[model samples]
Target: MSTSRKKSRKARASRESSKPSKRTIYTAIALVSACAVTAVAIGLSTGDSDDGGKDATAATGAQPSLPGALGADGKGAKGKNGKPKKTEEPWDGKVKVLGDGSTSYTGPQPNQPKAEKLKPGQQPPQFIVFSWDGALQGDDRLFSHFRQVARDSNAQMTFFLSGMYLLPKSKRELYRPPQHKPGSAAISFATDPHIRDTLEQLRGAWQDGHEIGSHFNGHFCGAKGGDDWSTEEWKSEIKQQYSFVQNWKTNTGYTDIDPLPFDYTKELVGGRAPCLEGQKTLIPAAKSFGWRYDASSPGDFQLWPSKIDDVWNFPLQLLPYPKSEKQVLSMDFNFLYNQSGDSTEGDPAKYDEWLKLTRGGYLNGFERVYNGSRAPMFIGNHFENWNGGIYMQAIEDTMREACPREGVRCVSFRQLADWLDAQDPAVLAKLRGLDPAQAPDWKTFLK
Candidate 1:
């Protein structure tokens, strides 16, 4: 052998001699066995039969056999007749659905004896007003609740919404994941993935024959950290709002299904001021936007052309708050607490009071309007408040009491507009002539 080869072989033998021997291998195997035994004992002590079975399977590669019954085709399993069982139908979970039908706006006139009594085929002056404000806050439970209330009352309500809430932001961050609140469950209402889910819900309401109106962009203002924008700012915001709705329509192919009847032209029509802050500036700005009617005012319920333009102002007659002294006191406290951000302690009593007051106010307002023969009552409520089970029940109860009564017709803004459009030119002209500031009372009109 060469000297170099002998030197290399000696070096290799020395390295091999330095390596650990069978003792180390035995030690590792013993440690692994101890761990497996410990795990099995612990699992058994914990009463985990499955763990024991798994361990046994791992050790032996053996599993308990299933039933040996053969199918008609001699398959592994069989049905009652001994034939191979077919796969079961998918477990379609329960799904909620709404009804389909158009709600009427005009009811049969009150009396028929006198010559001045509404002539046959001559419909009474009916006004339809839609208000959209404060919809779908934290989970759409409120929105859903409001829909149910409206359904029960057979009242077709319109909703106007700002697209800002529909946007993804910290406002909606808490709803992102894991929490699974009502509004968060659907990706359609998400900020980045802004789908037409909200719109579709509204459109479904529309398809079922309800009104869908715009609440304006960034109009959430109030105790909730909402935008405190001016009239000009609001106008700019509404432009964005309009664009968002348009985008949703385009993306969802809703434009193909049913294009919005009113465009920017033809007085794109009804709107409710953000925060009910319908100042003088809003009226003029609304006119400039070619809006034919606005529902934020607290004046008479009648509709007339805007003071600035030909638009109409259908003032909101009632909010879902009670008229009792206790209710008022509670509301005042809640308002203060909410404003101060100290409402961490929710008051169900206060909420109930507010509900009672709201329901009472609605009932009173309805009576006032119907009894006086003024325009239809333009009632308003937030999706947030209306969604409360108690509040929703109160609303349903009040509407049930009022909607079926004489001279009371629950209608939406679109239906009101359509009815107005179909009215006699002279009546419309007379309505136009009547000063909105001091219109004839319902009593006078009815008399």
Candidate 2:
């Protein structure tokens, strides 16, 4: 045979051997496409199953395993009964719930005590606090910027680190050093060295007058199987949170340091909820654990008493920073997008809307408190929001404008709690006389 013919035959054989067969490629494509369709269907249903009886699929056995999953009625797909499913987009619907403007103050009037009156231009007792909740892995640029901003502002912020973020050596190195020991019964994240460093960084912040608070381990509330967790599971979650902080104190050679003495003073004391879930379950649990306040309720931009208990409840007072919300929502979207693993950026318009709502909300809160001497301002935002420089800058700018020397006095949550604790017993008695059910406007107490 000619050399050219031999080479041609050999090349044909090699090409045939190297490439996947047509049937195999087709089969792979079909599988992937099927998954993609299934995910898209799921994305469209997003939390509908949690709405109780409203979701038809939930009524049946066809409940959604993820957010945006189609209901059993096949709203997002064809029904088994041979009908077409109703389709919904993730962002298309409006949230039906609205905030009740009701005030909590109800009871015997304080005789319209003149002592409740504020002096000219004097602001009511309020708190200006921030939180860094969540594990430190997955986003370095955002956290690095947060550390810088906190240092520059000389602000005392709280951080709630996750134990999962302190994993294998590579993961541990992603964070800054006391490397906590792994898997203590109470403190699950203490085992990793990198987590130790993160804790150390937090301690440094505390030393610099910032606050270090617990973000519970195994309490990613919105994650699969997180919400349905049992009471025992919830107990463990709180134990992990308390243990992480306690262990850090002991292991980092700071056992002798007591950031907040037992005596009442302006100290930092607060926690953010995991996945912003667990208010009903965790609030009582937190009180049992000696936590005086929780920043999980998104009910209002001020502190309130828990419906289930007397522990002070500080809802996330500040709307999420635009970038932070985008990152979080994008994760949800990616789950819908077949876990493509790509992060989504916030739209300019969306960012603007979030800022306007948040900043304006804060100003409105200030005005209300300024008018009503009874309530205090408790603004909150997260460290992860600094992912984009602009969002971070906006938060910093808002803080400077709102809490500057001429602006509102920004007190840590702990400070506010201490101040409340220190008031004369008679004064508290008079304040508590106001009906908590009245939902009185804070503005009513102003001026």
Candidate 3:
């Protein structure tokens, strides 16, 4: 990049970290000072697939092979000499191709609600964003399940697509993950069938109004992972990720699958890195690419977000742990890791208690924002059935309990971005004054 652009990014980052405000915006901004409300947002918002319960998967062609139980260990099938491999049946007879036959722009993002300024003195709605990483539809089938859950609860969520999930194992060699050898990936390559199933889900989710962000490829974590990669390496990894998604048809020679809805180039905004590492380098790329947000940061306090290089720094927040006086990151893995160390199968006796604790952490996090700062709750999870799907239940319970309450809108990160953009800067400045625990008297403070 250019030196001038680098200087500008540094300036933007400086502005993001140092905000000029009296008290905490979370506290003072809560009042919204009647003057801040310019216009009221009207109408019920639309989400991914709002066609009155349309079955987006009722397609005539493209059948995915039966999915199997696979781990993210990169031990799936491979081609001879590590080159792009093939399947017995590349694609079915029916095929719908789009730009370069890579991805087709189906239509406008389904049900994307237009953001409008808040009415004077109207308290901002409590925004909660639930997201998943390494969006692979494995034997668990949680991807489709959560889609139903979100639909039932009238919420929209984000699914960060792991590029390797779509890349057929036969063509695994095509991926050159940063800091890793060619054809090598930290996450297991999906069998052709898993990729097919994931594609189907991706189509349905995008059509249903959910957002798809890049999880990059190869769940490389720990040493020599994203944390160890440089900005240039990150750029290469990102480019390869998009390539894997767009060129899946050619890689696997698959036909008959309808193109995914929405152009990915336009749809993708930002993502969390593997293990929440490598963001210092990643943010520069995000800024240059004009990504709206980056969620790779770890353990943030529950507060309204600010930009990093003019891009939203949507970090995973720290949540109160009922079991301990300490706090935990608001992610399922963190809770589980704390509860059972690294073991997926912890003592069955503590199952209920662990689940309750996870649920409590999420609720506590939400409550901290809803009743206090009104910061958007960011919860991340995987599709794994760790601890007998307790995390899933906890999240579902949180959604059910928290979403139906007054002034709550469980939404995608994209929606949160729009809402943040709609707010008046002065009002936002005041809102930023609030510490997560600090709540000011609305009537008196706004006046």
Candidate 4:
């Protein structure tokens, strides 16, 4: 459906479109002293969530300042030059309330480009997906910051919300986490203020036309975590994830705030498994829930996405490391681990070195696919300031540099799946045959 990059993006804008943290990097680091560091360590070490709003900031030992939500007021805030900072208007779609009025059916997502099959000999556009795990609205408000970044960059993203974010600590009893005792969770429970902030941000994100996927409940990892969950256990997790989103009003007793703007039962589609574990059982279990994709795997060579159990599998890709023969997984925590070892707060002197490494790795991976296979690049990140907010900077740099290029489309996983599903299978197969960094011989490849 996309033709010229600029033209197609405008067409989609004539169509559809779309962060973490609840705190500043400094406050985030300070929060670590208050127990967030421990929380983040457990999550990051397990290979899944970094708990971006609160925990990620602690674990990464990052403390970069977050630009407060761009155009945060929705009426559109102004810039330093005294000009209005541009932002898309909120969707004015039809809405219908759901259970306890915690969620509602907003109309078909606004600005969402309709997916259409490729022309007989069309070249595939470059595709990139940026995603967040544990979408928390902690004191840093990283969630809101990135949303603004997306809007400003004309990009859309997926926020794999941890269901626990909606279930406040006081009401933690309502949770029945799989493979663990009820109320038990791998990540810390949210405070009342954080919950309220998170709720507002979530509502704003949907209204902005981004996709809302689940990061599941509890964030369980390790020997008794999601890795150990049975099919039924995953199902139980999915159901509870739904329940929390569906009944946040009842769960949190927040009557004044508006419910989420989309029907979650229908809106919830796909997710990345926490710690990138349990796909063997979780994929099939997700099938029953009618999810469209799963992004639980740790790494892949850049490639066109494929499906298992009829659901899309969007794994993170391996990227070239600047100074090492070893490639790295394309997520913030991995980069942090590689650079700082076990320390979230590694040598502050190496901050710039880490930042450059982080950015270079992503750019190397992206250009490889952009000029070659055109397989979508998938990146997973937390709203973390780990290594001096390098990952976040890298993402913004990617958006600024890539999205405006000839045919690059920085999009949500759902949008990518829609395009993939719309393609001819033979063409997809041919496209997949191109190596990750192998430039396509388009004339022959497409024919």
Candidate 5:
């Protein structure tokens, strides 16, 4: 590491030490079980609520600022005063329906930018991956809403689809989650209509260049949750995720609906474990299925990513809580937990304030990496409308403000891994060595 990097680390530690200890990061995760009921009772449950709203996949450190504004005409950043950007190209190949006709093989995914090796001394683009867990399209229509948001912001996100969402409740017994009864699940199974809507969103999301990764089946957490699962059990879970997605047609018995526009087995490259637990075994289980990345880590600082057991470990980062010396995890549940304790329905009066803080926290993280180390920002969220849907609003606003900025690429985990793989190992090593806020001399750094 360079002198600047050393100073940056020291400054970060000092700032952290100065803050009054409120809640420990692990404590934040442990508190999820208490709040799970609120998310579920609201009927917006994505099946991960029982595990604290699906993958807090987060940790604490640093902060971010400045909200952005954009329109939703589907023109992306290029049509406005914002920076010029690329848009998705239409797929030209004929679709070949795959097994059981639940999914099909469209050619290569559209709107994907080719991952090119960075030139020596060239500055890295700030990368932001906005990933969703339990990607179910309930009555809220959030799944479709964010898809439009991505198109308007020149962004492509990762939707971590829960396998149970594709498996109708009537066919629930077919799902054999390890350690749990064959038909039992922590959260509610998707209603048939919701499942149909979710399937539509999944089809369109992939066609629009978004990545469809797994959030695994049956959002189990804590005790018998992912945290306690053995490697073999995790492998069983992984296989079932594939099984549910690939055989949704068989399970749903919907003859009128078209097959999903991509082969899930081939398209799946990574996943975030429910409640961000069980990653120790999850990593090996994921790797066995040729996964390229895993976003199941509980927490880490906002830094450049590194591989764990050769699989890209994309942990949710901690960001500075706005206007405070303290930091919060980058996921919505952490923000919700901090603001209202275990209750999802906090002070309605403070909704505006909470939303402001949440947006600021994300922007603070974004601003830090965008202006500093250019480390990739990985933000995890669900589609629930907790706390009057403030978290959802905050994320949408952040996307508009950040995605269209110069030298920023709002992409998916698979895309990030692709870009990382395209770089020289030494270059990546040097990049990862710098502090999150340390902007080094690029020429010498790469040289």
Candidate 6:
């Protein structure tokens, strides 16, 4: 990281600590129904919590090999050493600019893995998706940093970009969020420099083979949020999300930057809702647009994904919270809510311990599926440096440790969906049936 970037991170952290608002609250409103099994309570929203508890896990030693797990090249019958081989770019076509030069069609995306069906008696690769919400390139430069992180780790990720991040604060009234005043929003609009930086990051991210999805606009939660909106209201919100991104060149009146490399309508295939709420209506609205998946559901076990109404329901998962029987949602906010209770800046003396516990919890989840069922792991995060930047460190460490392991493929949600679509449905059903710790005899199981 550069000196200027380090200073920016410290300045952002200071600002967040001094002026906490509804957007920075990180509150847990109510636990998801699935968490009832483990007697754990947590919610997804912006608020406060008073319960500060710590938990750790015993290491599940010795990874049991999947008998016939495929290697990185996607053709070999078993695992191999070193980094997974990335596929070459599939298209070399002419760019076609569209709609006032805000976006263009640049042919098929590059460096994506080929979605091949599992051979008979072969085990599937271990997949882990590291996604970011509210993808903004603030003064902290986190968006740009993580792009380099992904390149180093040989991973492709999903960045749910907030549409309003592109619309300047000067033109705030251009947005009319449902059930709120024309310009009102739960989150702050990006500054002019931040908007420009975010645009550059989005452009590079897509070109680098990362999926640029939506975080919607305005980011309303709790009352009058996605929860309260009807299907039609959800439709209106979705429409505005597209409008803001598609018309950013007009909205910002900037001419020097190149148009985004891919068309928004075709590139955008999914999104995660604010607070992981409103999937009930959001799904229907999304389906109308032919979206392939939705990642807004709050909690589920670390198992293979299944469809809801023919749309891939990619929910945030529940991972083992170390040193306890309870499970926490696989998101940075949940970890912060549990360890420090509503405070982004917790006790300084405990920062190292908290970082260990956070990193351990994710690793525990990874080891379970890695050695046993081989289900995909979904880890979500934000760019904000909460708890002295421990969570950001935890994620980066996890990616470096996990992505290069044999038979492990760190992919974007879109790539995961494509792989799932190519598999035999009955085989997927069988794989989904295995417990998170149940390593099966692949030769017999798939046969």
The TM-score ranking, best first, is: 6, 5, 4, 3, 1, 2
TM-scores of all models? 0.51, 0.50, 0.77, 0.80, 0.81, 0.83
Identify the superior model by lDDT, candidate 2 or candidate 6: 6
Full-model lDDT, candidate 6: 0.74
Best by TM-score, which number?
Answer: 6
Model 5 segments beyond 4 Å from truth? 1-94
What digit string (tens of lDDT, one per residue) describes model 6 on residues 1-447? 234323322221000011112344633444323223231222333332211211111111111111122222212131134212222235557887877777877888888899999999998899999999889998789999999999999999999988888888888767667776666666778889999999999999998999998888767666676787777677666667766777788888999988998777667778898877788998877766657799987666777889988789887777777887667778887788778886777998999999999999899999999999999999888887888889899999999999999999999999999999999999999887877778999888897
For model 4 the TM-score comes to 0.80
Tens-digit lDDT string for candidate 1 (111-194): 111223333333354333334453443444555565666667656666765544444442332221211221121112334333
lDDT over C-alpha atoms for residue 45 of model 5: 24
Query: For model 2, where is the 10-residue window of minimal lDDT?
Result: 13-22
Predictions in order: lDDT: 0.38, 0.37, 0.67, 0.68, 0.73, 0.74
What is the Cα-based TM-score of model 1? 0.51
Candidate number of the best lDDT = 6
Best-to-worst order by lDDT is 6, 5, 4, 3, 1, 2
- Give one clash count per candidate, in the order shown: 20, 34, 21, 23, 8, 6
Q: Cα RMSD (Å) per model?
A: 31.2, 22.8, 15.7, 14.2, 12.5, 14.4
Report how far residue 255 has shifted in candidate 5, in Å: 0.3
Model 6 TM-score on a 0 to 1 scale: 0.83
To one decimal, what is the Cα RMSD in angstroms of model 6 from the true structure?
14.4
